[model samples]
Target chain A: MEVEETRLPGIGLRHDLVTASGRRIGVVSQSTGARHVVLYDEVDPDAAAATVELTAEEADAVAELLGAPRITERLSRLREQVSGLATEGVPILPGSPYVGATLGDTALRTRTGASVVAVLRAGEAIASPRPDFRFQAGDRLIVVGTADGVARVRDLLRSP
Target chain B: MSDAARLLVELGAVVLGLGVLGRFAGRVGLSPVPLYLLAGLAFGTGGLVPLDAPEEFIEAGADVGVVLLLLVLGLEYTAGELVTNLRRQAPVGVLDLLLNGLPGAAFALLLGWGPTAAVAMFGVTAISSSGIVSKVLTDLGRLGNRETPAVLGVLVLEDLAMAGYLPVLTALVAASGGASAAASIAVALGVLALVLVVALRHGHVLDRAIGTGSDEVLLLSVLGLALLVAGGAEAVHVSAAVGAFLLGIALSGELVERLRPLLGPLRDLFAAVFFVFAGLSIDPNDLPAVLLPALGLAAVGVLTKVATGWVAGRRAGVGPAGRLRAGAALVPRGEFSLIIAGLVGGAVVPEFGATVAAYVLVLAVFGPLAPRLADPLARRLAVRAAERTAQQRAAP
Candidate 1:
């Protein structure tokens, strides 16, 4: 039996399924699929919800269109991978020497041993900052690499 | 017209005059706040026009203005941003606070004030210019740059310290005649915590409820909340600005985003009256006696803050050029210093209060000039440093 397709509002998802004794069976998901779909079973009613599936390309496209938890999760994973190749985070202070200098000008990677991957400023997430991004007096930098590299950057920034 | 109406009209005239003078001063590249104070002086006892009202009334109004200013400042607070800044600038901010505050307290003591008074005075001066520094950095298009964050970080820490300092000072002052300082402080803190929790937990609901009403109702509610919190703080032996700032912090973000535009005109209207009242309290004849000392103190205050800021900025890993820029950017002492001085000194030594007020007025007049000076100074320093580096390379 052919089942009717229903689109969820604002979610850009259409699902086709069969209702058998209050259970959704043989569910098919369709959309510009970047979203992850979860199936839940209700014990009280003994019914199964529609199954959701998306292609990898569709997942990315959906993420771009809808900024959801899944997209954030993916970004976090990517950041973690990059950070694994670098050092830990470095603390910056006002007037300590690193406040106004940029990554390229300071030659942070070459001089310090760690590469700066992200800068968090004023509650905003700045990911993968460019070499030209200047350091502010109160910026916290996430650096990745060897432990010594991280210490080196910290020392340079803190140097009087 | 009744006395109040007549007074209001006179106040309007004074504001208009100050506005004109401020505009003229702006044309000449001077800060307008100073000019407003001067205009106020002209309308006081020593000048041609005398609007003799009690000092307390004028002070009360100015106090409201200060609270409003802090309210705006608190609106800028973001938890995540503050944490990041603290991690970066805490070490340097602490050092600067210690270095500047110690010396300032000693200076005040040497000038014959008691230990408590001296300490309070030190707090007033140790904190750098938040509004001035932020404005200058933004104007130079450096706010988005890395150095801006550190400078902002230091200011944020200073503001937080000031928050704690004001209450401590108030408690000390209140306890002077053998009152219970600890109890007073505890009550104040308790009330503050309660207010914050309520604001945070129910602010959105309150906003929605009030927002759905007419504009007048929304305005009234906003004003009512501000006044209530401010009044509550005073009732609990705390400074009103502290209450307002706390309220602001709780109601900030999305709630503030919706309420600020509605509240803007009211703040401006009250703020305008506030400055005019501040000016009217200034006696013109006293200016001659206070002018030299006030200017001297103003210079000291500005120079000390700038030097301290630059030193702190450099230690934070800001480049030499950026450090100099940050230093110059911090030169203006505006509303906050004036409010603290007024609150602490007004009741104890009116003369000292007047002196500090005069100092602030002069600084405000000089405030706008800092940005003009900072950009050129930063550029020149950058060039000089670059040339020196090039020369060293060539010689090698």
Candidate 2:
């Protein structure tokens, strides 16, 4: 996916990402520690469909899931790798290979040993998703496991 | 002790005491500014222990502190950036002045401080502490929030307003009421415009003139130029602080980045002196008389500052939570307010400084904790509001 980021002057940087299905994801990155991810209306790209704002810690968690957490945090996580514990979020969008598929069909857990701890949809939390649980667009899957295992699940859900 | 010996001992003791108090404030997660003020009061005349030193020496050091405070503030933005912010956000700035400034002026008049004190109080109340606000934003890790830009915008305008305001305040204090005051104001306007034009047009020229060859040369040249400009401005009846600020504006860009490490410590040291000096001028006994009004003024300040921040954030389309956070970040008044109070010291009622000291003490303590407190406070308030609306709708 090609992501275009534009600096908004005194404001911040706005990153516009288009998924393969043409869904637009806009993330505004503040120079400090705040990042707001907005889903744009399909027809009116300027209109905000929804916005998920995150603080530094929360954003750092998502960044770790995206495989690009801050250097310091990454180093700390590496030092703590003895526990083989990690956490990240994967946004469910249209055209994602895992969308519309049941968790059982994806074989994500079998392949990566990572488990979907929760599926958050429209502000609703669905915990410990069953194998037959269906994934829908905009559902954020909270995957937890070792770093390598989490990466595998992210690849399965996020990448086209 | 001899005058020189007394001065040396008192000055050293005050600075050291301020250092200890500052560390305590830091440990307690509060701004050390109010503590510095309190320290000043303890050593001032008619206070707990009157300093035996010649007051002129501390006053001179305080002057330098004021210059450095405004100077470093100016260095944070390029002249171009300042101009752009001024043009776009002039309305918001005007709104801030009207909403925040009016209360101070009205309160002063009501107190019978007369117009002179009202003008001084107007300035003291109007400007938010760029120093405190910036520190809070950074400490809270809120620099990236949606409402941060709006907050910065207001700060820039307030600083720019100071460029025009300080000169007027100086002229007003000097001439009191007469044609000389008008003349002084005109001269200030001329000086201000000329400084702005030179800064915007020839800032790069200055950057080259004050070459960043080595830190040593850079420090001497930058400090030398600021002092020279500030002195010249004072000679011409323009405020020295404004002169230093304009010089900082001219030296903005890569120069500021280079000078930050060199100047940061010096600015801090002198700025501390400035706060202590303001405190030193006040009599602690006077605070008892003005404490009630000062508290009321602070209440007004808290409300107005929050309102200004919220309105500015809303204009920028930030959500309610972010808006509240921005408002919280803005509540504290620090260095600039002290500088204003110091400037108007004898020109206003003798107790005016005490009022300012009391007011600042409260805000400084409140400002640091605002960001931490804002989230829960905003949430609870918002929840209660929602419940009230729901009840109202369901009743009919």
Candidate 3:
């Protein structure tokens, strides 16, 4: 992935990433620790098509959306350190086995070595999600463990 | 009817008229400044039906409008940014002054308004409307453009320069010549420098004073603080606008941001009233004689302002298209110009205010629209230049 970064002299840093499908995603990290996730115009990349301001928590959630956690330096080391120990997001699609089920009901964290550490819903991060949290379709579960454990958790989530 | 009752009734009608006109402007996707000004003219003395009421209240409200406009503008940048921008953009700022200001001064002198009027009109033509330009940027969604920061730099420079310029002009226009005049001008400069230094150094005093709450107390405190400072400046014979601007520069961080949403609506309402008061002060009959001059100034205004943006944007390494956009963006002259014209009063040529009002009305309407109007033209020129470059490369 090619990400272009520029320092916005006196303001902060701006980073732009062009996804494989040619979607240009921009993130402006302010000096004040605020972040603006800007969607650029498809034709004119300079103009912002949309700008969504994110709180600290939501910005972390967005990091997960970008694939691996890439916000802080420790997170970057975690990406390499946990290589095959796969940290991945599994979506709770409609008609999936996990729909309407509680995290405790899944029992998959115990069954497989994968731990559901966080849940992303409605653009919010529920960090260290509780066992009692309800599983809803469109919920993105961020799981961390061995590849085998993550695969098993994915299967558990997909099967109705 | 009693005098008070008639005044209240007339004021009510005026407010209603402004509201309706503002709504219409919003519906049609235009700034309501010109419309509001025209409505003020209609309701003013020497118009079709002048309002027969106490206008003292409106006059005071208009003064508050100027202070708030500058204050909010100052709130847009931090004191540090102001200093850095002024230093970095000094050359462009000077060029902008020379290009845009020279014409107005020359025009005033050529029209035989004398050196004093020439100086006053120079201030009028030189300063761009930070208020109107900001609105236009937001409205056009050009806040993220490559050249916007450059445009903003130019505006900030103009504002900072105005802080000193207004005080000196106030002194000059107050008295044509005397040792007392020199003494007052020096005093004004000293006060301005003192405020700037205090703002730059001990601004945290203001920060702590403003507190964190975003309620009515915070609102009243902020408003009161501005008025107190503005009043103090006016007492010292400097423009109250400078006082408010300096105060805005002193307050920064989260407090400024929190104050914005609370102050936004109030700023708009009072700012509209301020424009109306300006229009009311001008007689309609004087506009015709000045209209031709106003038009000529507008034409000159475009060239000088565009040249300013070009120098600024090019120096900042912006492309031709972006530079052109910057130039057009700087075209509108609104609040500050009117305030300067107001300051001069009848000291200059009798029709000075009329000329300024007409000039501003022309530019205020034209300024915001200039960028959008220039976009396609700039793109075409850019495309042609790019084609030429490609042809040259192919031949080689």
Candidate 4:
């Protein structure tokens, strides 16, 4: 978990850490927002075995893909433990009335007895989003409740 | 041919020639600077074919080139990073100055070029080519090396030194009297200090002011402001390049990144023109005479730079091989060296221009290859150390 941070003067900052497998890996975050993933050579610790340059968008996608799935897996495990309890992902469409509004504005829990547990945006999970957590188009809200409550929450989200 | 038509034709040919030269340099894995100079020399006075482009156009372009070069250089770091590098590497930077600069000054004095030429030569030899060094690191996949930060630290310090040195040298070059020169240096330093303060504390305010607006508007404002400040600084006897550099430092935040791509092509074009202008100013005939001394200075330059890098790497706690790579990485003297020589104006010595041209030519071409020497050199040293240890064991 320990990482070494090195400032590259005019270039950028590099943060490298050694994995449990004895592999040294680093990400150089450049001033221009590009990221370079560097794997250090075992024979020569000073040199890199491989370097991958990623654009800002590509880096975001990589981060999202790496992070988002864990939340889904944990939630899916909980769903298996309870027979009546259910979870459904409801995405905010462009035409939805609450697209730009906060989660509080919907009051889905009061209306349908379903709780919005988390919001997934760009592969990042915002857990236990507060009332004021704003909704953006394409945000996937994880609603958890009884199967009927979850289906009603999804219908409400799709319409309003 | 009409003057306008002839100018267009000549300018078109020159631009195309530069493009070809640059491409060839790229293919050969060399900095295009030396090749640009060669192209300039070929078309300059007493070469294969004289360029018929208006003198004023090239002069103006070259002037803008220096400004853009300095501006872009300053934009590479924030004021905080500059301070951090200065704080951490001050000793190494000073060593770099003394070890590399003194040789050039001594050589100039030995050549009977006097104090002014010594000052000029000091700048020429002291600074490493950051452009070439950075490219070499990227090319060699050494950007992630342990010694790279140390190498880059040395370069940052050198650049900071140049910001201060250029203004003082400009004052010295312009003023004949000792009192006036001293006064001018004081003024230059005062302006420099004031600008640094503004860059550090009030940078965000300037950023907000200059950084807002569309790309076109931002580019125009920044470029216009640079020219205005450069002219103002020139009027006050500070180097115009320093003024542009100060402007770059003052404007920071997200704008710096955005401005980089917009200004990059502009910087490249003008920078090439600056190199060519430097070459055109030097006569090819004068090169032969100065070649010997320039070569001598270059050899000394290589050693001193290596020494400087060695010290820098050691300070950063790099091992022997990494230290050698660091040392070799600091050997090239490119744009800044030429800039110093150009600022010298050949008033100090008749051969100053030619000497610097040859010196830069040798170093710029050789600098890229110098890093390759690091591994072999390190192995040789290791062998010698092993031999000495074995001899000691045998004696006992």
Off by over 4 Å in 4: A68-160, B376-396
Give per-residue CA lDDT, model 3, range A87-141, as digits (tens). Answer: 7788999888678899999887789999987787887666677889998889998
Clashes of 2: 0
> For candidate 1, lDDT tens digit of each residue in A17-135?
43555443332232222333433233211111233456877665554455432433544566577654544556678777767778898888888667776776775546678989988
- Taking all chains together, the TM-score of candidate 3 against the true structure is 0.79
TM-score of each: 0.64, 0.71, 0.79, 0.84
| Tens-digit per-residue lDDT, B42-141, candidate 4 | 8788867888665568879999999998888888888998998899889999999999999999998988889999999999999998889998888877
The prediction achieving the highest lDDT against the true structure is 4
Query: Which digits, one per residue and each the tens of the lDDT, describe model 1 over residues B232-339?
Result: 787777788788877676664455656666766655555555665666665665556766766776677767766766776677565566676566666676666666
Query: Between prediction 1 and prediction 4, which has the larger lDDT?
Result: 4
lDDT of 2 at A64: 52
- Between prediction 3 and prediction 4, the one with superior lDDT is 4
DockQ of each: 0.01, 0.03, 0.14, 0.33
Docking class of 3: incorrect
- The 0-to-1 C-alpha lDDT of every candidate, in the order given, reads 0.63, 0.79, 0.83, 0.87
Reference contacts recovered by each candidate, as fractions? 0.00, 0.00, 0.12, 0.58
Best by DockQ: 4
Candidate 4: C-alpha lDDT: 0.87
Q: Could you tell me which residue pairs clash in candidate 3?
A: none
- RMSD values, in order shown: 22.3, 13.9, 7.1, 6.7
